[model samples]
Target chain A: MVTEGREQERISVLGIPSLGDRFAVFETMVKEHNISLVTPPVTKHTLSLGARYSPEFACLPFKGILGTFIECLEQGADTLFMVTSFNACRMGYYAKVQEQILRDLGYRFKFLRFHSSEKGLIGVLRAIKRFSNNASWPTVVSLFRLAVAKLRALDELEREVQKIRPVELEKGTADRLYREAIGAIDRATSFASLRQAMRGYFERLEQIPKDAEYAPLKVGIVGELYVVMEPFFNMNLEIELGKMGVEARRTRSTFFSEYTKWGTFLNALNDEKKELQKFAHPYLKRDVGGHGLESVGEKVRRAGDYDGIIHLAPFTCMPEVIAQNIMPFTKEGIPVLTIACDEQLGRAGMLTRVEAFVDLLERRRIGNILR
Target chain B: MRVGIPRALLYYQYYPMWRTFFEGLGAEVFVSSPTTKLMLASGCSRLIAETCLPVKVFCGHVLSLANGCDCVFIPSIHSVEQKVYSCPKFIGLPDMMRATVPECPPILDPDVDVNTGKRDFYQAIYKLGRPFTRSPLKVRKAAETAWQVHQTFQRRMLSGLTPPEAIEGMFPQSVEEPEGNGSHPIFTIGLIGHPYLLYDEYVSHRLVPQLREMGVKVLSPEMVERARLRASICELVERPYWACEDEVIGAGAYYLGRGEVDGVVSVVAFGCGPDSLMIEVLQRYAKRLGKPFMQLTLDEHTAETGLMTRLEAFLDMVRRGKRPQGISPPASWSQRGGSKRGSASWVYLA
Candidate 1:
């Protein structure tokens, strides 16, 4: 509550674990802006604490974020910044609801919600400025650019890792290398070092002796952003697929690309998403909110290329619920398995489902080849 | 051609306008019967398990209409007001209906988005009318007449009539408000919820009339003026994104703050995202004002006796003038031996 010595106090920004590459970029930006950033590691304890405090029917992402926020706050985070939307999805209300719940529980912290509906980069910059204690515009701009570059490099490395995961001769090699790669990217302070780190990581990934004869089953991961991206929420779905010798391709990986590519002011412009809108037209027709349209489009577009599609979304997610219902009707020949993740979902159950789906895909492929 | 409109969701609110619009174009409009056990069973069987009850009920109506109608009209209403959107389920209702009920007739979905501009809103209406008539001028005329009828319907509600009553008055021959007992109501209680839940006799188990029978007058959000409701929500940190939620919150805030009503009862559908948040909002506000507040969350399995017992108990507490002053932990109102057919749960937040 004391504003006089606020600068002397540590400023910690809560990070979403789902944003794999963007997390590193965010850390870099915060450091450059001269603000201390604190990212509490998300664990089972975090999930429990979040689930306990959150409304019973709230989505997994909301509960996960609440849990992470509480953890960060416990570690002396004086400020919490969150991105909120005014869309049709329940996502729009999560911030306000979480803030109220936290406040009710007597947590003392400055809560700042950035409305994504705010036009262009002005909203984002304003949020950045407030978070950075009004850091110079030039400094903010430079750091943002650096973060974007790092994010791009990180995404490329992740894609390479995903590609090599299933066919690697040495099991777990891709996972181990990817972890190290993320660490390197996070530690890289300069743009050149970031590029070099990514290049080095990709080279290491390529060296993982892969079976040339093995045609790995390719499964496209589609659904809500958090579940698709956050390994914990989805119970390490991609990793599980890798262990089963299946390549998992995600639809939206480059988190910051949409905002960063269109200069600082035009952050909301998403041309790639426009193409998805077109692709999903036959089934979805329009945006049903959240990433519902994207989920449908990605599956439809990649139906021929992928062996199967796994849709992971939180329970009670309206848009994904709509998508899941319509998916059966699409009849794209690709087996689509929808996994609704929530606090009630257990690891064993999720693993069993994922394993069964992989087995089905493998059988279908084998059957096709034989025929 | 006969056009079917499911008496679910927005049908309770906009049936007058839609019926008028379709009838003006010379199409015989048929509305599905009120929710019944058969419809609920059929809906639950067809719909995805996670969707809210109203959506399932809508699916049932679609199924009913599929039997005899040429096409079912389901509007994808993105935003009814500027800067405020509807729930995602409402926006994607048409698609969900089509996907769920494979036996459903052809769906005539017209996009109604006021967020873009007024022109787009009218253009969407005209596009929906194009299939009914050739002349754009005739469509415009029909739209204008329908708008007037819609305005009149809203006026009737603002004049202190419930949504069902207003709709009944609008279509005297088609629907009728059940005649009230000659006894005058002794107490007033604000009943807040979406029109679909509040007015649907089968979903609510005739809660409005039951309250009236017990000498309590029900005041719904529909009775309040739109401007006043909007003004009342100034206390909120942000305007609720969902249009119906905004109104409910605004009206609930007004009723709770005014101190005239004995208590506020919110009827929420299970799995409704907006209602879940709004209930919290109303609970917190009601707690601050030291008012008796109870949330009746309904699903397909809600029992009539359990609901009646909770209502009777809530009313008794109100009449005794023993409103709980402090905030209480959320507690379920389920009774022993209650029918557990649906996932209906009640939470009492004083």
Candidate 2:
């Protein structure tokens, strides 16, 4: 508070590579600390840059994040935030390797890392303190709450978009509204304004002219989180399916929802997750690391709801590879189409496969109707 | 009861303990035949194209055990160390086998995660023994003996014996020393990789035997003690999170830093997840130290002749020693510097 003349340091959290809008939350959080936030969207340049510097056979998400880091550094981001997991996947050591690569590239920056499993809320507070320019705890905590509220609202908007996209009368209508909703949500400066923005968008989304006679084919998407959530990595698969007049429902929740579910005692009381584990128990009895358990569980659990299941994964993703191998034997009698996404995946090839799968699903439905 | 074990993956590291335990429990143990071309082909046919070679080999071994025994033993090893996991493929091996490998016998999968306290660890052992005999006392005795044998195997490895030699010494009649024991080797090469890749002659293309024939002494990660490995791996900026990294990063760091071996060779399966990162870390470390390092990537298509050519070239470079210090010309070049060499240099420049 005493030094008003200190230069402003720009802060940037590790970008999700696809969901650039989520960085707005971090921007708001850093605002109280007098640090500017650098939020950059993933581009082709980012993918190529990350792939060049990353170790071959490292998963797709790692390359994307590494590319984003280089981009952030170039954009005058002096402080970078990243979270590492404790165990299970290769994700835990991502920060370590990325830090090494960044240092070797001769980038001058400060890295603030947190173990996703360790220290819990206190760890987050301490990490914020490192780059927060000595902002008071109460202000930081309030701003953090506001950011979490915005994140939850943003996730809700994403889910709402998915529901309306398939049945909309005009294509791209829902996507355009989503972009507009995001801008309005980002402009909110308080929790009440955030709530107002969310509610208004929810009403506007429901009012969009949707096809009343269209009964869309439902497909459950399950795989590694980064590929499932990141549109660029999966080639905007959800939107593509929606454009084809098929509804894409993601079996896995976003990161914040996952935290709320497992990070708290609600994990024990969540019957939906319990049912998933129960159904998956026969096939995958233990966690195979990453989303392998969830992938299997969601397939079995949603066999009745989803007309088909698309197992999207990165090539050589250890857990998902195991899941894909075991999926056929789940014996849920549901048709499964596994698409392993890698840097080499082509949009034309992916669309052809997806089109064939949808055709099969439609034929199966007709066969059932005749019977 | 006849229990079969696939001679793959952790089998090279823990076969002694498993064999001793099965015998003590009054069950005849049948280990699958060593890795062969036919076995690997059958395994690859069942799995997707992207699985690492080691897992594919493991599947092949499991398929071989289908008709021989009443039940097959496949352990779901979550983690050997606290908070450090085995590769996902290993943790989910039993599930994969059940789904893909047709006509496989009933599997007895005992979970082993040392992080789950002593009681849970013993419970897993008891689960393994219950199918053999009803008495808990027999199971306890078998577990105790198995632990001792595993410890002995580890100690022998640390005392300058390779895994194959140490395993052979466990059989009382074959306490013979390794061949060419007294002869001093011209070059000692540090071979770093997983036990399965290092000891599986088919996968490794008989690397150890070939090295021995070439008057080279081979040292593997198993020959290093656990405490020494722990100390050596601290050189890394971040301690590796994989349970089996001691075989790759730890051994590579030790050999490169201490100059204990003249050259370091890391053998990695082509699509292996853990080895991908571990190899990068070691390769960069070796480069920083200006050490002679070679990476031999193994896959289904790895040809023996190609591997041999690379091995010979790397060894030849090691024998030549470090590059001549400065840009000094050779004696012949200096003598002809006035005419022939100057013309050749001009042509090269052009």
Best model per DockQ: 2
| Candidate 1, superposed: residue stretches over 4 Å from native | A1-25, A32-34, A119-123, A263-269, B175-177, B322-350
- Compared with the true structure, what per-residue lDDT tens digits does model 2 show for residues B99-204? 8976898998999999898789889999889988999999999989999999999999999888877888887554654666436787888999998998888998
Best candidate, lDDT-wise? Answer: 2
Which tens-of-lDDT digit does each residue in B83-195 have in candidate 1?
A: 78888888888887877787888899998888888888888888898888998888988888888999999999888888778888878886564658438876788999888
Q: What is the docking quality class of candidate 2?
A: medium
Q: Can you list the residue pairs that collide in candidate 1? A: B301-B342
Chain B alone vs. reference chain B, TM-score for every model: 0.90, 0.89
lDDT of 2 by residue, A103-154 (tens): 8899988787766654556666665565566567887677657766777787
**C-alpha lDDT (0 to 100) for residue A289 of candidate 2:** 78
**Which runs of model 2 end up more than 4 angstroms from their true locations?**
A1-20, A128-131, A261-273, B172-184, B322-350
Q: How much of the true A–B contact set does each candidate keep?
A: 0.56, 0.67
**Candidate 1 lDDT over residue span A1-371, tens digit each:** 43667655445544343343347446655665556676666678989999898866677888888898888788777777777877888888888888888898898887777777665766666655666676778866666667667767767777787878788888899889888877787788888888788878778787889998987999998999877777778888888888788998876533555456665434444666777778777777767888888888888888899999999889888899888877878757678999998887899998998898888988898899999
